[model samples]
Structures are given as structure tokens and as C-alpha cells.
Target: MRAADWSTPRLGLSELPVIEVPNHALAFGWSSKSGPIRRRVDDCPVASRDGPVRRQRARWAEDRRSDDAIATLIVPIEVGIGLRRRPIDDVNAWLDTDVATHLEG
Candidate 1:
């Protein structure tokens, strides 16, 4: 199997940090002021790079299946070891319908 490219706008979350089983995916639970949510991704999408440490902004948008609209957006303003939380300002900043899409499949 091959890893998915991460250098494109289609990429959302950061590189996952854990052991992965081939052909399987994982989802992590996150909390916010509204309630709790989950972020799911296939593990075969992270790319490897070298050199000095670099930082990348990781943002998440949740689109409700009912109304086909985004209900929550989370952006972590601060990060720590195994813990991350987004401030209200950051959430508001990145929350928008910039990527809304409709597909006929």
C-alpha cells in the first residue's frame, strides 16, 4: 500500500502518531464547548520529511449529515504532549464554509 500525499489542500489533520495496522483507519475523540466530537482518518496518509522541526496548522471542520452544513470547527491555538485544546477565538477564526462541497456519486 502507498501513503496519501499530504502537501495538498485536501489534507486536513496532522501526521498521526501511533502504530497502525495496514488497511485500517483510526478516529480520535475531541471535546469542545458545544459537546464532544470525533476526527477520523486513514493512517496511510502521513508523509515523512526531514530536517529541523517544523510546525503546521491543524484545523478540523465537522459537517453535519442532516443539514449538510458545518456545525463545529476546531483549531488548536496551543499544543502539548498528548493534549491539545482550541480557544474560542481560534475556533471562530477558522470556522467558515470555505470548503463546502456537493457530489453526485
Candidate 2:
């Protein structure tokens, strides 16, 4: 689906400030070795495997160039080994145990 092009968006008066229009956003927290990492393969072919030089970055900010109030939604989940539905408690425990051993599994 796409935005309807039937009418033009009017930037007129409003109670909410323009900068506060989009006062929300989401940010995904991936491992540093995954993303937000510099493409410095030249510096070290296996720079990613050379221990964590940079920690996992799950940060958010309002870019000085834009008025969008981006908000970060970071949630911690368990890292089980097997493919099985983990219990709600286990999922939020942040454990790295095998899912198969779980009672629910």
C-alpha cells in the first residue's frame, strides 16, 4: 500500500509543533559485530572476529538535520540454541541455554 495522492499535505497552523509531529520511532539492537560496524575489511580481514572492539550499539537520536523525534525501542530476548517456543519467563531472562532442554520445549 502507498500514501493516497488525492490531496496535497498542507503545512498550516497546528497545536503541536512541527518538530514534535513524529515524536516517535523505533531502533533495532543488533550485535556490534552484526551492524553499525565500519566496513574496514582492509584494516583487518577478520576484524569482526578479533574480539569486540565496539560494544553493541542500540542508540537513537534526533538528527540535527531533521525534526523527527525518533524513539528507540530496545528489548532484550533470550538466545536459546534449538528451535522451540521458549516460555515467556525464559525469553526475557536473557539466557543462552538450549531451548530443547526447556520444560515447555
Candidate 3:
């Protein structure tokens, strides 16, 4: 994760370095201010990003679902991935909805 992308609340405690699990991590116990909590990541997808993920992921997300001749990011901030923590096809829609056109003066 990049500097700007990381914004998780900080937790202070003795921690072990991140290591590859033998098979999979069932759960990790952690002591918090409230109490002890267990972490369960059932469908965590770990990917190796070569470059800036935002621009790349945005384009790739649309391409994966769009069938149109051309796909572009008209309104970058408004349209984005889905609620399920995966890329959604919000970029490539019908021409009318995708972009706004005005007649020349």
C-alpha cells in the first residue's frame, strides 16, 4: 500500500513481522483497547501491483466488463468500484450517460 492509500487506525502493541502462512491464516488474535479480537479473512485477494494501482485498476476494472469499442474515465471520482471491495463496471456505460456533449455556439 502507498503512503496516501493507507489510513487504517494505528494499533500499538508488540507485533510479529509479516510472514507467509504455511497454508492459510485461520485467525489472528489481537489485544485491543476494548478487548481481544480475532481476525478472519475468508476472501482476501492479495495481488502484486507493478505500478500506480488507482489509474491501472480503474481502467482494468472497466475493461473487464465493458464490451464497447472504447472505454474511458470521464468522471474519475464519482464512478468507482463496487461495495464488495472489487472493481465494478461503472466507467463504461451508454454514451449518453458516460459523457456530456454541448452544441457549438
Per-model TM values vs. the true structure: 0.21, 0.19, 0.17
**Residue 10 alpha-carbon offset, candidate 1, angstroms:** 32
For 48-70, candidate 3 gives per-residue lDDT tens digits of 21222344345543563374423
Q: What is the C-alpha local distance difference test score of candidate 2?
A: 0.25
Alpha-carbon local distance difference test for all models: 0.28, 0.25, 0.27
Candidate 2 C-alpha lDDT tens digits along 36-103: 33232212111011122223423321131134422222233333332123332333232234322332
* Residue 25 displacement (Å), model 2: 28
Candidate 1, clashing residue pairs? none
Stretches > 4 Å off in candidate 2: 1-55, 60-68, 81-105
Model 3 Cα shift for residue 41 (angstroms)? 17
What is candidate 3's CA lDDT for residue 5?
Answer: 37
TM-score of 1: 0.21
List ranges where model 1 is wrong by over 4 Å: 1-67, 81-86, 92-105
- Any idea how many clashes model 3 has? 0
Say which prediction, candidate 1 or candidate 3, comes out ahead on TM-score. 1
RMSD, model 3, all Cα superposed?
17.5
Residue range 15-83, candidate 1, lDDT tens digits:
423323334222243223112113232211222222122232123232242244433333332223321
Best by TM-score: 1
